[model samples]
Target: MKNGEYFISKDKALLQTETIHQFLSRSYWANRRTLAQVQASIENSICYGVYHGTRQIGFARIITDWATMYYLCDVFIDEEYRGQGIGRRLVDLIVQSEELDGLTGVLGTKDAHGLYESFGFVRDPDRFMKRRPTNPWA
Candidate 1:
């Protein structure tokens, strides 16, 4: 534990794919990520984990160029760990990091828009976009 109550750390190298897979499986939008995909994502992006006595209770990832743009993805908190400000702390650590300082952080959420809003995220009507991928296995 980092501060005697919450375990916070930014060590993707130590993340187990199985743990991440289980977390994403419970996520509302990302229940289909496979172990291989999760492993690749963890290896390629910056990831953070919140632990409760060695069990990962929350997770979040950011895909960024470290210069101009960032997309926050796959944020989830174990149902047992919700309502304790862990999610806020996770977001805070990411947004306040030097790696994301000058970039525009973006994320799409079906729920919890209010949480992101409290962290300065806003809906940009002009930034309309579309998804091009037709199949995940393609």
Candidate 2:
């Protein structure tokens, strides 16, 4: 989808792996992820990349069953490109995509709740649960 000078696409082939690794490595959620891990994750998930002409400026991924549920993760817009509604459009496409519509969507965020909430995400602390990896570096 095109938005002004930016566009979003689900073509994994269009993703710039090095650029994505760079962005994710510094992210609060994926800070510990290695380049290989990021690559593996992208290969396994339905991926999206936001681009300006040719350079990728944003990314997101959805781990889903295509029928029941999907976990949205690794969502980010370049620090230089934020505040431009690029992230919003990237997510809007994912949530409303035919593959994800009608399925339960969940995400984890220490901040930026407002962003997701605007798209119908509600905090469910009581129902949410997680099991941390035993190896911190794993």
- For all candidates in order, the CA lDDT equals 0.83, 0.92
Error of 1 at 2 (Å): 2.5
lDDT of 2 at 136: 61
Candidate 1: list runs displaced more than 4 Å. none
TM-score of 2: 0.96
Tell me each candidate's RMSD, in Å, in order.
1.6, 1.0
How far residue 77's Cα lies from its native spot in candidate 1, in Å, is 1.0
Tens digits of per-residue lDDT for model 1, 1-138:
275677778887556668879878777776777788888888888888888877887788889887789999988878887998888888988888887898999999888889999999998868859685679754
Question: Across residues 1-138, which tens digit of lDDT does each residue of candidate 2 receive?
Answer: 888888999889999999999998898888898889999999999999999999999999999987899999999999999898889988889888988879999999998899999999999999988997899685
Sum up the clashes in candidate 1: 0
Q: What is candidate 2's local distance difference test score?
A: 0.92
